[model samples]
Target chain A: MSLILARIDDRLIHGQVTVGWSRILQPDQIVLCNDTIAADPWQSKIYKSAVPPDIDVSILNKESAAVFLNNLPLECKTILLVENPEDMFDLVRRGVKIDEVNAGGMHHSNSKYEMFEYVYVNRTDIAYLRRILNSGIPVNAQSVPGVKIHTIDKLALDAIESIMP
Target chain B: MINGLVVTHGELGVELVSVVEMIMGPVSGLTGRSNSGKSVSELADEIKELISSDNDCDTILFIDDFGGSCANAAQLAGAAGSSTRILTGVNLAMLLDFVTWRETMPIDELPRRLVEKGRQAITSMGPVQEG
Candidate 1:
């Protein structure tokens, strides 16, 4: 498929994606799908600046990203980045085909609990992730390339059981 | 006086600061941090908090490498037009140069000097001169 790597990381266009994953994936284009960032020119500028000038960079909202990914050229290798699981769910719901989802970073907050070193999730995040999982797409948590990939199913199940009455 | 914060992947930052301090004696305004357990945003927030804690002095963030998580977090922390400066590819010579000239040099010009010093520190001995 043209869409090679689809990932969920809060810090989009950062080192892990740019240096770590990009070097391995070697995608021709990196597309960031986020509504808030796409809407803000200044924010878009900052994110775009982090990427190298050689590779193509596009920042589009969910709807536009869905359309773009649907029609992407077969030869164009692309890395799809979304900030959160909600965005991934929305993209999947909007008919953006993805082979697998890499869960990179979901930093800690009061509302979230640590699932892995780089992954923190709350009930809402778990629910959305479950929805994505149920759609037959595998979600794996791996911070950088060449690291061990952990499936989110067991962790999500444990988390869901803990939160339920 | 300008303060420096060394941020790296694991214990590299901490060890670099310690070695520099060992060579040049104790330094008061320099610290090291690790990105072992923290995520990018968490690391960025920690950097922001550190910068805000000592608001009087201009801070310089020494990152292990460019296009790494430490550098990325440093960029995020410094993106809002703060008085902080980020220098990637940090080395012992750069830290030494910073400690030596921080009090004398202006913050704006210090990064360029450190970059030069860091680059100059790397050299080959040309296959060991004949005795």
Candidate 2:
């Protein structure tokens, strides 16, 4: 398994992920682990085409991805993509030894607590990822490359709590 | 005429414009959102107006994403004719070459340009395979 980078982003795949992230990491294979995207072929095609043509992309569900991660091929650098904490938790439960987890594009939304001006992590997501961190996985938040790192624990819980209704 | 439209969601369009201009010289189009930011649908309608206002013979609108509001709006606004192409995933290289070369070549040659420019932007950075 050439899985070097693992990221959790609700957008799954978009401009920031494809254009910005792809240029930095140059990951040959981008695997998006989301049940919804895997089930919908058309959605998969749309995301697949968004990525630079040279890079291969797979939209896999939780179970299949668990198996894929276990027996990852020894080849080019691969990036494991996920939409939320639940997916990450699922992988952890299935024994995906991801040392680091990146949080990207978790924009402001209803029911989400504001951790930063542009970032809002839901309580459930925070708790779940915290568990992963407590279990020994390091969860870091850097919207894009070359920005100051936002450690999951150091994330502004006060700011988030203030935004909660 | 191999015309193209660049529809940006946020300030990202500004960067796209620079990239496109670097490759294509000067061009005209719409950037989909205002600072206050209305819905993607609203932005699409405005872009539709911009394209329709030009009345160009052959146009290709490059939406940021196939699933984005601008791209969807382009589809909804109905630029489905053969002469008009709706492309998703607009990149700096694609915009630059497509716009710059379209002036010298016929619209029929656009497909080749898109492929060439797209391929040029890709650089393999990981482990190489042994044959």
- Which prediction has the highest TM-score against the true structure? 1
Instruction: Tell me each candidate's TM-score.
Output: 0.59, 0.57
Candidate number achieving the greatest DockQ relative to the actual structure: 2
Give stretches of model 1 more than 4 Å off. Answer: A160-165, B1-131
Could you tell me how far off, in angstroms, the CA of residue A24 lies in candidate 2 after the best superposition? 2.2
Q: Any idea what lDDT model 2 has?
A: 0.70
What are the clashing pairs of model 2? A1-A72
Candidate 1 local lDDT, B9-111, one digit each (tens): 9999999988765444457889999999999999999999998898899989999999999989988887324478999999988987798789989888898
lDDT of 1: 0.86
lDDT of 2 by residue, A1-165 (tens): 477778888777765566556655778888899998899877787777667778888889999998988888777778888888778888988998787888765777778876654467777877787677777888788766655678766355545655667
